[model samples]
Target: MKKQAYNPYLPSWEYIPDGEPYVFGDRIYVYGSHDRFRGNAYCLNDYVCWSAPVDDLGDWRYEGVIYPKVSDPLNKDGSMCLYAPDVTVGPDGRYYLYYVLDKVSIISVAVCEEPAGRYEFYGYVHYADGTRLGERKGDEPQFDPGVLTEGDTTYLYTGFCGVGDRSRSGPMVTVLGPDMLTIVEEPIFIAPSEPFSEGSSFIEHEFFEAPSIRKRGDTYYFIYSSIVMHELCYATSKSPTKGFVYGGVVSSNCDMHIHSYKPARKPMYYGSNNHGSIIEIKGQWYIFYHRHTDGTNFSRQGCAELIKFREDGSIIQPEMTSCGLNGGPLAGKGEYPAYLACNLFCKDEEIYTPLEVCGWTAGSLK
Candidate 1:
């Protein structure tokens, strides 16, 4: 086997560094929901997109924002509170972005011909009876916008909350049109896990939101975030467009690693693991998620070791990725300097916060 060099990628935000990432072309595009804790920007989930090109499995070039807050089609008001985003390069050469807006709690999309561009808004999906799909009051379609393609057909899987009369686990599958703008089929119920109370609100959670999908050979696996918004769980089926069964939970149920039930410490506690994405490169699969370092508030960026299936055919749980991973350009790097922690410095600084230098122990720098 060729010992390929490692690319130990870590999480970052445009304004926060905990912004999530996805892959397109030879580069990884990272996007995050903006979080401003004070002033007028507090809790506003605005979004920013960026790209990091990986030439070898060693280093990456950080390209700046491709898209910023322009409009909110769902809210119809243009107030900028964008949430998690999923990017896919369509077979037709256009790039589609599906994201959520916080004020209206609905998922919407915009498309462009280039990987980085000013996207044009497309119409949204609605229920079969013609009621708008996400207009429900409390339970908005939630995290991890997982999309999968089989042949000419594309399917979307998102973690949703089943509010009121809806099924508690939420619908996991909805077919997207070839144009990547609207839904083609009615959304289907797939993952039948237990209900949870998610977010700071901690209301009754529909199951299996924050989903990521991957197809290895003939099997399609749907990895999801679970357990009242803390643990990572997964399900699988042979078909990319069909039956998905619960695959069990990853991470512990307690706050031994961090405190999850309190504010300011929530990200360090137990509330930090949801909204994850997975991608494979050079034969290894990587799980990217968030975690808390102190309390159960906002989550910080986190990743897991590449999961490998045992010879017996069972897959192993992903180990929590840290600054010590033996991959990418920053493998042997030391501590993250204090200056790198300031969100304001990220845009202007020419330095790299190498994966080797990130983690709770690195300490938050400003």
Candidate 2:
């Protein structure tokens, strides 16, 4: 009999969210922000990794801490927390990890010779004048970084805009040189923020944060978390940096917009901010996302669902399922944990889990 894979593919105790899955050679490695089991804040731990052979999605092995919070000079005392990150293999055949500190607006870079090895601090993404990307006079603050390198050029996608915040324009893309730390082209807004989405295709689902980029054939898929917070949405463009049209939701943590089993507006599970991207493993495409757990938004676990792309290059939103990554339905007989329940809800049918239920405030624990 074959081993069956379940949702929250990692061990139950692990809290790895904002997953960016990539297939480097024969293994698929997942890089994401590490969250504490029951922590007060988001991503309160160092960056760790987990990977598995391309042939087996069920056998995940811990890759240990690939990067530490204190490794960056700006976070010497480890006072700042590490946020969501993305990894790209550079032109030099080295792996580069891009991330931003919790309190800083600049994007930082770390490099390693191998995919899952310890990464050393490289530098901040800056300009020829030596000013960092976010430190420029009129530059927007850099947040979740999603990067893709083709040949010697890398497209860096980043931004964090809250609803009705005019200061933030939207998700922006910048071009980097071969070095991967210096900007070759200035930042340009690919989508509209909530405040500026009046007549745009992204009117209702304006870009919020967590911008990741992937290319399938000739189409560039830009995955992001919209202002809705619970769903991971996507945009498609022929070019890497411009003319992006809003696609539909890839997956929702609370199972919203799925009317096949229940009302479209009804949320079946506790939902919060969702982040992740799509990856193709062994010719199969899956969306890697996270879900709120431990009754709090801080502790998040990763989840993935099989996604299909239409001939026109559109993806239908996938429903949250307990038998994710299994490639098919589970066997008729087996033992499953209660946490694998994808349709979790109370009699009240609450869509979101409130922080008060977990005795957690914005920046402090009660």
Candidate 3:
């Protein structure tokens, strides 16, 4: 008998998406929105975590529930589900969580002293006019907040989708005050030009979703899902908020095998929003993204692959793999969690997929 490789990292029962990976205190922790297994609707559960020592990706352990949906103010209206989030170490040496309430599209912040621990709701981001964004723009949406705390200042990157349109203010970066709560400056747009945004396939759609910001050497890498929607594209700049040049692509949620994707008459994997960051764990670089499971977007599971960068700082697209964090196949003997199965097959020749939180599925594509 041969050993099988693992992809989702955790056991099959745990469904987590929008994975944001970070390294702290000799351990690499993954923070992502918890998805209900076999459930409907995107991000139907709270935020949970999984982590492993920096030396061993195969030793992943559940970090328990970090944040609950019921604690959110929107829970009063029964419409709150935590979305994708990013955490940064503040100047005061605390971890700050940045995310948006799913329905309201309002960016909220949470704070805790430790990663993957209980987080207390902090506050909502506001504008220079002193009006909270949630109150000012009821119709307009501003969600998917990514934060980078460098030196004494923290930069918050947010996306404001134009109503009924995909393109809007381009990549926005705002400076946050010391509390990591209030906006310190008017948001600046790090515009992606025609050459950089090979992603803007639809003129009507721009800066679609999922943002991650990191600084390598002196260059700032602003990673997000551009107009291409499914693929994770990136732009780089010396400055965090301006002069961004599109740096090809990172990877696609459905098509991780290659970069050049032509429009097809047929469909692909259950395409959901792709959210992850490029983090250097130990000395290796990896692209962390999620894949749809059980033939539904809502039941998505997190997956990652190792990546290499060119001398020019452009990333080579990585292929989807079953050996995701593990580096190799698991031993034939040992108890493994359900989430780690990569090659799922049917019990029989029949396939009968069910409705997920999104309410519809085609019964194909495992």
Number of the top-ranking candidate, with lDDT as the measure: 2
A best-first ranking of the candidates according to their lDDT comes to: 2, 3, 1
What lDDT tens digits, residue by residue, belong to model 2 across residues 277-296? 99999888999999988789
Could you give the C-alpha RMSD of every candidate to the true structure, in order shown? 8.7, 4.2, 5.5
Minimum summed lDDT over a 10-residue window in model 3 is located at 345-354
Compared with the true structure, all predictions reach lDDT values of 0.50, 0.91, 0.71
Across 1-366, the per-residue lDDT of candidate 3 in tens digits comes to: 222436776677888888888999989898888889868788888788888888877778888888887767757554777888899999999999988887775678889989878998887777766676545653245678888998768998877443344435455777887878777776776754223344544232346678789888798888787555556777788988777776767866655335344233222344456778888888888888887777666787888878889998989876555675655545557665544443333332112223432333223212
Model 2: lowest-lDDT 10 consecutive positions: 357-366
- TM-score versus the correct structure, for each prediction: 0.69, 0.96, 0.81
- Any runs in candidate 2 off by more than 4 Å, and if so which? 356-366
Q: Could you tally the backbone clashes for each prediction?
A: 28, 0, 11
Residue pairs that clash (backbone atoms under 3 angstroms), model 2: none
TM-score of 3: 0.81
- Ten residues in sequence with the least summed lDDT for candidate 1: 342-351
Ranking by TM-score: 2, 3, 1
